[model samples]
Target: MPSETVVLLPGTASDEVFVRTVFAEPLSQVGAVLVAPRVRTLCERLTALDNASAGHPIVVGGVSLGAHVAALWAVRNPDRCAGLVLALPAWTGAADGAPAALAAKASARVVADRGLDAALAGTTGWLHDELTRAWHGYGDELVPHFEEAAESVAPTLDELRSLTVPAGIVGCTDDPVHPVDVARKWAEAIPGAVLTTTTLDAYPRALGDAVQAWQRAKG
Candidate 1:
């Protein structure tokens, strides 16, 4: 059988380098060609995947905004996507007013008003903790990419409710941005979706485990 393709979509203010570094090795074990696209819009990203894969069935996954995008795409292209792997998906509506949104908005405003340097100084620590320092060692190279990514996508709640693909939502109990309850809600909404919770520090490990489990269930 042909190996399944796994598309990795990075969260808001993230780049391909960071997402690739986190999932490349572990996910590769499933013999999946990991495609980490740099696009921001959900439709454009999914279109890119469709054009690249040429109708091959795929597993779609992403972090934060990326996760939201993946979920939206999987629902829209249910026949093309085999499943979903969502990490730290941002909540919409009432869930948006949570601490995570306030912090993200504040950070975005600072970057838009002050500059990347100032915004990075204040927000880097938060992102580092959430992503387990995946982009920390890359220095300035990752910052501009992140800023560009953030500018590419905006939040849309309607898209969130339409997801239908079987999904695995990986969330952190301690993450203010991706509350465990919100993740659970995503799983509950999607038919046969599963919500798995882990600590912020164990993100990579939890993601790897969830991917493996999802793949096994598919077989």
Candidate 2:
């Protein structure tokens, strides 16, 4: 009856701060230790996940590109994954023209051609603030990280169906970049997966709902 460990990664151009803000309290409520690694690259995020699960099975999850990476890892290492808590899943299989991917690619170009401020100038509200902090934290690696995430592939529907672990997929109902339909598709493909909807302003609820879904599935 040991407490579970939840290793979460941030979205593209994001930092551990965002992960902690969204998942830490909810995971603590369920007596799970939260590991939010501050990583700028996909490889680092995956390595963090692998390292965290080396001792025992852990719940693996992330937001957007982070979610895609975590899901891909869980598909490959089901034995080391207890469950998933995915948020704002952007796409499946090939990223291609997925809105989130396209945005990342465009942002990368802006960052490369103009500057960080120019890339972020169009964003507003909470997203603006979040990106401002995260993009700044990325520093020299921002553009490359954005490009990598833009071109990254998520777990295919077949891969998701092959997963034996429970999954909790969350989506922002009004988010254009991370379509709710994508989350729905993920939930449908994964056995015993739960789909929850919430707004960006109440994003933390998405984590709570996801954890509750996992707990329900485990029970």
Give me the candidate number with maximum TM-score: 2
lDDT of 1 by residue, 93-164 (tens): 343355555555666566557755676564445465643343443344444544444444423445555655
Q: Per-residue alpha-carbon lDDT of model 2 for 1-219, expressed as tens digits?
A: 798899989988888988988888888888988899889898999999999999899999988888999999999998999999888899999987999999998998999999988988998987789989989988899989889999998999999999888788788888899999999999999998988788867754464567776666676
Q: Considering every candidate listed, which one attains the maximal lDDT?
A: 2
**Model 1 worst lDDT run, 10 consecutive residues:** 146-155
Off by over 4 Å in 1: 40-44, 92-98, 123-165, 203-205, 216-219
Candidate 1 residue 209 Cα shift, in angstroms, is 3.7
Residue 5 lDDT in candidate 2: 92
Question: Each candidate: RMSD to true structure?
Answer: 4.6, 1.4
In candidate 2, position 91 carries an lDDT of 95
Q: Which consecutive 10 residues in model 2 have the weakest lDDT in total?
A: 203-212
C-alpha lDDT of residue 197 in model 2: 84
Q: What is the lDDT of residue 38 in candidate 1?
A: 63
